[model samples]
Target: MSPMGIRLSPLGIGVFCLLGLGVLYHVYSGFLTWRFSFLLGSRTGDTVDLRELLAVSVKAAELGGVEVKAVRESNKLNENSKGKTREGADEKLTRGDLLSNKKMANLITSSFPGVQVNTEEHLSEEDKEAVYWNRGIPNEIKEIVKNPKFVSSESITIWIDPLDATHEYTENLVNYVTTMVCVAVNGKPIIGVIHKPFTGYTAWAMVDGGSNAKTRASYNDKTPTIIVSRSHSGAVKDVTRRSFGNQTKILSAGGSGYKVLSLLDVTGNDQETADVYIHDTYIKKWDICAGNAILSALGGHMTNLKGEDIIYTGSDGNEGGLLASIGMDHDALVEKLSSKITSK
Candidate 1:
């Protein structure tokens, strides 16, 4: 048959589509930012999912955001909780509370069965002791601990904070609250996810290469915008001024994740604003890990005030302090910060 007379079969069309997969790869993965916003993105999610842990985190964040925001307008953020446990007027605790550790735990466990979860909130002292003693841990969780360091421990924890910046969230500063999850092996972060529910933004990265994404963010700012804790006040301002000097602008913010988000934020009409996040106080590992991954993926850095990377041994008491930044002078910022004395 002549070429014009030959009709293409369905199998031939499939061959053509397969040949053009490079375009499909870009089209499929390029919209990660958009796909994650709606939690409609398809991804693998098993305890062994590794870098795909990013998508599991996005799912958990969606669940947490939905659960938390549902009660915001009706419950008034349970102002009477006094930021305490869910009791009294906070009994239902489903209000505008940003500390939805349990909800996230539930969502994550349900979604990623066999993956160990540790959040900032939890049970009674006796129950805590029981969990610590492994008096009640399920066999599935026990089987996942491949690390020798965790053999004596409860499990290889996916450290999490369902919602950070509870105070700012209660005060209607919703953007500052975020959901975080981190996977650590041998006390080092291998995978991390930082999800900002209010803005529908999520970012994640891993030390290994299962992630199908890379970063293209600009990493240079002469006069950087510095971010500090909005709710907690300390010598952070003075230190920022002293380190970056009068040229840099200071922004009071809440949540370690939120501050890092500001660095990669592109909501500004002009372009993305990249800044440095400084915290002189101790923050939990879950709070910082997800941000660390995103920053690292973008060729940025985060470390203790002593210019050391956190080992993530799972401690809430972080005395090392935090310094995270992206852009041209990242190393210089770290160098200068190393010398700046922190009174905290």
Candidate 2:
């Protein structure tokens, strides 16, 4: 039959429609996969989860993978060569020491199988004893050990947990995997990272540091945006209104990683980029580490209310507060608002 004379059967038409639908579904699925893969791979997308990332990191480390390293014990050469030894370096306690000594290793091993726990040897018996008997360290002291880079600055205390929300992982196996990390100089966080594991969401920033601008610009349209915690809307509003004036527009966010990731959204297509200040009322060390890494790498500021730099591995692990900025006026902004924030 001539091409024009050939009449397609109803069965053929139905088959063709199914084929088209299948093709379309496949294409759509492929697109989503690509998008998710890209975001996860770059570690820059909003949907990325900090906890999951850390869990994966921990899992990889367990398998002898190199995605994550313990900051305290990993750099022994530098610690030894720098001649910077802690007070009881030889007699300091380690995470392993605490775990083994307190018989907590079995608990951690049972919860997170194959994951290695390495505690800093510099921690005094008191600190180790606390962590051993308490199951978790005080938030204040945990902040100090998380970020060791600021230990010498005398002004900075950086707290970082490549993985946060361990309880959630252990309890429900929920995707609420969070990485709690922050940098508090003078008892405040100038840089922070809060990453969610399941959703692939991340919040990161450098406050009062000149680095957040570039980092924000990379994810946003170069517009200054401040990220505030949804849970701390009142505190954020108070601080913003008092410091940036009531006219200052603030973006509300959830989780430390998500807040920082919002700043990285450069498109600015959404109303999320109306302003340029990212704020978190309260933050711990593990929630801000990776975020700090991103901000510092990008040239931003991360500090605490006292206008000090966040340090780590000190005898005392407490950091005062957290403050971050994405632009050049970070120091000026911190100085201006330092007096306004109520002491915690």
Whose TM-score is greatest here?
1
RMSD of candidate 1 to the truth, in angstroms, is: 15.8
How many residue pairs of model 1 clash at the backbone? 4
As a TM-score, model 2 comes out at: 0.42
**After superposition, which runs of candidate 2 have C-alpha atoms over 4 Å from their true positions?**
1-177, 180-196, 199-214, 218-224, 232-234, 266-282, 315-318
Tens digits of per-residue lDDT for model 2, 48-156 = 2222223333232122111112322243212212132222112222232222222222222333232223222223444332211112223432343343221223443
Candidate 1 lDDT over 1-344, as tens digits, reads: 65789887889999989879978888878787555532421223322434234445655666667656665645556554434321112222324433456566655555444556767667333322110111222233234322212121223457787767776666666767777777766666666767666666656655533332233355446677778876553677887778778667888877787777777644632223447788887566877877776676556788887768887665655677888876656567777777775735
| Best model number under lDDT | 1
TM per candidate: 0.67, 0.42
Q: What are the Cα lDDT values of the candidates?
A: 0.61, 0.42
